[model samples]
Target: MELTLKGLHHVSAITAKAPENFKFYTEVLGLRLIKKTVNQDDISVYHLFYGDEKGNPGTELTFFEIPMAGHNQDGNNSISALSLRVPSDEALAYWDQRLTEHKVEHGTITELGGRQTLSFRDHEGQRFILVSDENDKGVAGGTPWAKSPVPAEYGIVGLGPAHLTVETAEDTAVVLEGLLGFRRKGTYPSTAAGQPDVIVFETGEGGSGTEVHLEERNNLPQEHLGRGGVHHVAFRVDNEEELKQWIERVRTVRLPNSGFVDRFYFRSLYFREPNGILFELATDGPGFATDEHIEHLGESLALPPFLESKRQQIEAHLKPLDTRP
Candidate 1:
């Protein structure tokens, strides 16, 4: 069967503080809070989602807020950075000024794969890049949030190339190429000395959100999953039938995957790549508006049918979060 993974569906991370995470992504970064939900697997933790106005698949960046969690270690076998697409070089400059005015720590603009990028870390030290794609190949476009502090023209487009740090790229390359339909695009010099070259992989089409860069760090220590670290990076699949095909493909390749799991908003199949980073293949249907009306999204806590019985108990344990922009 052919693989139809288009681009990123969402990049989910862990945050140690709920209030700070809520403010940083919604206010500082200017993304809309699309869903206020709890982690179905662990109801005590809050699973908050932020994205474009309509909660489009590629625009999403979610979080599992757990105040007790510790800091994450920087090492191999992890997603080190997430790149967000912007419209042009002007947008990059706008972000530089905006971040500085807000007292956010960010680096000056730099070039990566011929594109201008501004690197910054969130309050919890999760790295991110604001990249300009004037050609519009990588990030098609999306609806801007009506209440965002950043203007629509310069707002974030969507999730772009995400950096995956691994000890060796050989086995992971096979999964990306053979099973996931990603092709080897090109190579770039590693940022760290003595590290293996960084390999670029393109899925569907060779554009911004469709690229994934793998950096092989052979001598680095294994990383522990905790706060400020990526929990999983989900790739976009069109619907249920396409999602089913992927499950069968995973079985044929003998990769251990969590067979179809319905996440009320979308269905998902979770698995780990050879290098140990959790990867998810999620469908793009019944999106954030399935339960609540479009105008009222993220205003209240939402729960799937199975968790309805425990809503009261869950709500009691989870702290109240004010998601105002």
Candidate 2:
């Protein structure tokens, strides 16, 4: 049986500090901090959830903020970058200056996909790209970030699709198109976004939202897994049974994948494409509120039942932040 992934879900990253990460994504980037908690397995570290108002599934960009996490080199076995789409060039310029004024290090605006983009790094060194798409899907349903300079109408819709840079485009294509159920969306000329060949896919709609891109960097540097490096790219599946189908299919192709991980809100299985970039098959069930109420999200330290015993130690280690926007 084939596992038809619904679409690209949330992207998780590794961060070094909670306060700095919160400040950049929520304050500078204007995303909402939806959940505040610690990693269930290792309670010493904090797992942060940032996204649109309700912390919707796809718009969320979660992180594990480990103190002084070392940096990784850019090579194979890592995700090079993740791109978030905005509504227009005005948004790009707004982000460019806003980030600069906050003393955030960033690069110049470049033209890509027929739009201007502003590139910058968060405190953890993860590089982010903001592109202005004229016909992009507007932000997911939710209240606006109170401090967001960008109006609620033009807030971040979701992942403009993520970039997986690989050594050989040939091997990566087979899995992207064949196993993952992604169709060839289109090609684009080189843009300021820094990739040569841009091939896009849509498990849902091909509009300016819910898409993923495969960037072929034939002889470029490989990415190291460290601070700022993406941990994994998760594809949305309907439920646990769907996730199981994916596990079986991936194994049929002789690919190695981990068993289903109960992530509280969703179940997941992880596998890598030919180029060693990590990919996850996650269910879109029992969402964020499976554990707490939507209005109370991120208001307190939430621990999974198993990790409740260690909450005291976990709370002591993490530096508290004024999570209020």
Winner by TM-score: 1
Backbone clashes under 3 angstroms, per model: 1, 6
**TM-scores for every candidate against the unseen true structure:** 0.97, 0.88
The residue ranges of model 1 lying beyond 4 angstroms of the native Cα positions read none
For candidate 2, lDDT tens digit of each residue in 26-95?
7677787778888765777889987776766677788987677788576654566777767667767777
**Candidate 2 — what's its lDDT?**
0.73
lDDT of 1 by residue, 99-199 (tens): 99989889999987667999998888888989898765753756778888889899997888989999888888988988898988898888789777789
Q: In lDDT terms, which candidate is top?
A: 1
Candidate 2 is scored at a TM of: 0.88
Span of ten consecutive residues with least summed lDDT in model 1: 135-144
